[model samples]
Target: MPHCLYLKHLDIVPGDRANPCKGLMKPITIVYSSKKGYPLVHPCTKCGHLSRNKVAMDCTQED
Candidate 1:
């Protein structure tokens, strides 16, 4: 599994019609770990948007 600080572009919101920023992949920065031991958070490089990943398998860092 990749570390929390890996670089990734994930969907800001999976399925939210009200989300203004939709259908866009934003770069993520794993700021820190969560107490639940499953919550992963990061910010988008393009829009400074914050995103979370529950599953480590869903996290990816690419060059």
Candidate 2:
């Protein structure tokens, strides 16, 4: 079974907490790869933001 990562409550308010609105709204989830058997390669806060996993320079050069 593939594990799923849940992301929620990602709202940033420029001002005070009172009357704050949800900004940049998004519900994010990550799934593990079946063949590679690797976890999501990135830094994700409990808030649900997924970091961009850039291909390594050396690996790309091989192709």
Candidate 3:
């Protein structure tokens, strides 16, 4: 499963062209999952755009 926490700038594509600040997925520490086990609400901290797709896992964690 993709973790919709923090992602790199090169990993994801821009969701909206109207957003002036284009960057990585800056998770706002908020996460919401749907009943079907899918991420429904994942907002970006840079542009505040809500991403409702599969996201990559956080890179800051050590496996």
lDDT of 3 at 23: 65
Error of 3 at 28 (Å): 6.0
Candidate 3 lDDT tens digits, 1-63? 443455543324554454445566654433456643445354565666666655445454442
Model 2's alpha-carbon lDDT is 0.34
Q: In model 3, which residue pairs have backbone atoms overlapping below 3 Å? A: none
Q: Supply every candidate's count of residue pairs whose N, Cα or C atoms clash at under 3 angstroms.
A: 0, 0, 0
Cα lDDT for residue 5, candidate 2: 37
Better of 1 and 2 by lDDT: 1
- Once superposed on the true structure, which residue ranges of model 1 sit more than 4 Å away at CA? 1-12, 15-37, 57-63
lDDT of 2 by residue, 4-62 (tens): 23222233442344423223323243345655443334334433344323222323222
Expressed as tens digits, the lDDT of each residue in 1-57 for candidate 1 is 434343345443564445443333343434445564555565655566676755556
In candidate 3, stretches whose alpha carbon ends up further than 4 angstroms from where it belongs are 1-4, 8-20, 27-36, 55-63
Error of 1 at 34 (Å): 9.6
TM-score per prediction, in order, is 0.36, 0.19, 0.34
User: Could you tell me how far off, in angstroms, the CA of residue 12 lies in candidate 3 after the best superposition?
Assistant: 9.8
Candidate 3 TM-score over all chains jointly: 0.34
For candidate 2, which ten residues in a row score worst on lDDT? 54-63
